[model samples]
Target: MAEQVKLFGVWGSPFVRRVEIALKMKGVEYEFIEEDLTNKSPLLLKYNPVHKKIPVLLHNGKPICESVVIIEYIDETWKGTPILPADPYDRAMARFWAKFIDEKCLPALWKACWSKDEEQEKAMEEACELLKTLEAQLKGNKFFGGDNIGLVDIVANFIGFWVEVLLEATGSTDLLTDEKFPMLCKWKHAYVNCPVIKENLPPKEKLLAFFRARQQPTSGPKYE
Candidate 1:
């Protein structure tokens, strides 16, 4: 019998979506357990003691933490369709871009979304520079790993989705405007229109309402 697979995740989390995309790409069948970050489940804590974060993959009761790590594990375990390149150098390059987007671009975008006034401006500048760097990196490649949608493409695609949400919430479109980063704007179109992504993405208006609700100030700490 095939080993049972389970994924603990939250719908809104990009990291969780990364794992979900990888699983779908690999043609792996698994159970998805929706996690509430505000009130973390005991099962999630038991499975991922360290970070207690979502996107934890469980195979035959063993837990694997982190979205990227889970993606790699999914790729290695299943052979239906390879998400990483066969060549070592190409694989390394894919990992490099994935790491770059995770470490630098994601945080910069978050800062830009949450910061106020001058800080928001500075964050937006940093985000624009990061997008320029990514646009240059994709000069001749259709996806991050060239013609094929690979690991890096899966990881980076979230930027397009979430950044749009942040732009709406923060009332800024400077980072993804056509004038500054045309290539990235085009890439966003491709990423969103991709069949799997188009099907899985959260509804825009609902997401907007969700973010707006989170942005509102709470009255006080209360017992209900």
Candidate 2:
């Protein structure tokens, strides 16, 4: 008998989308359960009691939490298109960038979007520097994983899709313009236009609406 695979996540979440795209890349059949982040489901709580977060992958009744961890688990469990490179050094590099994006790049971008006054300016600077670092990593490759979309590519989904919307909404495209971050911009274009990613992406208008609604004048930035 085959293992039962299930994913609990929100519809427009980049983290969840990464796992979804990986599943599609590997041709893994799984059940998807969308969770209301504000009113998280009992199953989400049950599976990820510590975080009570979505993007939890359940395989054969065992749960894996955290988007990056879940992606690695999916790659290891399914023997289809490989996510991580086989060489140990390359694999380690992939993990490093994935963590860097989640910890450094994402928070920096969030700050650029939500922080006010001097904080926002500082965040924009930090985000630009971080983006430059990421751009250098591409080394003119079609994707972060060289010729193919791999772990780092999935992890950096936000840059490919969400960043443009956020930048446009905030009137901050100057921070990541085609001329400023040419390689990064080119990579993003490639990443999003790839058939697998382009086809499964959430409707742009819906995603724009989701972020626009979140831009409340009073609320602090919340990294979901």
Candidate closest to the true structure, highest TM-score: 2
Per-residue lDDT of 41 in model 2:
86
- Displacement of residue 101 (Cα, Å) in model 1 is 0.7
| Model 1 RMSD, rounded to 1 decimal | 4.1
In candidate 1, which residue pairs get closer than 3 Å at backbone N, Cα or C atoms, i.e. clash?
Answer: none
* TM-scores vs. true structure, each candidate: 0.92, 0.94
Candidate 2: regions farther than 4 A off? 217-223
Instruction: Report the lDDT tens digits of candidate 2 across residue range 1-224.
Output: 98799999878888889999999999988999988877888898999999887789999999999899998988998898999999999999999999999889987887687666788789888999999999999997999899999999999998888887876666653577888899998988888999999987888888777777764434423324
TM-score of 1: 0.92
- Runs of candidate 1 with Cα error greater than 4 angstroms are 216-224
The models' CA-based lDDT, in order, is 0.79, 0.86
Give the per-residue lDDT of model 1 (tens digit) for 1-224: 87899999877778888888888877778898988878989999999999877779999989999888888888988997788988998888888988998888887877777677897788789988888888898876667757767788788866778778867876765568788877788778888888877766777887777776775323311100
Lowest summed-lDDT stretch of 10 residues in model 1?
A: 215-224
